[model samples]
Target: MATTLLLAGLMLAQSAPAITVEAQPGLDQVGYQALSAGRPDLAIERISADPVMSASDPAALINLGTAYARTGDRTAALARYKAALTSRDRYDLELADGRWLDSRAAARLAILMLERGKALALR
Candidate 1:
């Protein structure tokens, strides 16, 4: 009976849908691509050069936080994530796997993952 239950759980986990979170268009998108390419340094450079990226939008902040987290800068990452959480901007963030999330919801999720030492895997 235990073996059967284990197999059933494994099958359920495997059948679970994948979630993909896309970056905001433009610079945020570029930064996200850089991060995905494993170049967190490049992501930081691109996203940090302009304040406009973070000004009314949390997308860049979220990306920046992820990049910082990738680079092992937990403090900076948390700061960015926190800032993103407070941003007034609202938009639907579409994931690569076709799921949509509110930008703030994405930010909150990112924060939880970072706090738990998980790498931010959003697109």
Candidate 2:
């Protein structure tokens, strides 16, 4: 019985998703500071370094895209935002139709699209 319980516990633990430290607030602050300080490059780098802000994170991807756009990297910015959208779709985790896996994803995508000179036509 003890061995069965231990094995079950171990299996449960192994199945849990890894926790990632998000840099949302800090990245937001850094973004504003960099923008105000006329340093979009720094903002881009700071936000892009976050593990949670990679292509998989819609919110992070949007922020990264915005940063790229601010730095005049329109192509890269678009790519990131599109990648975010694609990721959101592939997960099929309830983000379809812009519901968003995380609440921030949709909002960030909207903002980033606007920044990227694309008008959001949310249905």
Candidate 3:
């Protein structure tokens, strides 16, 4: 159901990718791997290395923010999300199951931060 919603949301493209798929080389894989490896610091380093790239790829910015959030750094996480909001560029992320996801990084980050805060409060 969430995947379906993501597909529906992605039907609308605000603009073409800032960096073409071919141009990014292994960044996507590297970022994903870094995040999956419990190395949010590395993930943030790689993803935010290029501000332009991060600004363009919603996935990267979201991941970058996620990295920060995982480290309990809400300030940096929110900064990345706010930066993502400044641009209209959205990325079409193809999942392993062939589903595509695309959405507003800032909005997603807002929800994530809220959830993180709630989680902390409960603890």
TM-score (all chains, Cα) for each model: 0.71, 0.47, 0.56
Rank list by TM-score: 1, 3, 2
Clashing pairs in 2: none
**Which sections of candidate 1 miss by over 4 Å?**
1-30
- Candidate 2 achieves a global lDDT of 0.42
lDDT of 1 at 75: 95
Candidate 1 weakest ten by summed lDDT: 1-10
Local distance difference test, candidate 3: 0.46
| lDDT (10s digit) by residue, model 3, range 1-123 | 011211111110221111111114344422555555555688778777777767665555555665676676778767666655554765444433456444453345344644545101000
Clashing pairs in 3: none
- The window of 10 residues in a row where model 3 has the poorest summed lDDT is 11-20
Q: Which one wins by lDDT: 1 or 3?
A: 1
Residue 62 in candidate 2 has what lDDT? 52
Tens digits of per-residue lDDT for model 2 on 27-96?
A: 3422434533445477567666666646465544554565566556677767766766766433212222
Give one clash count per candidate, in the order shown.
Answer: 1, 0, 0
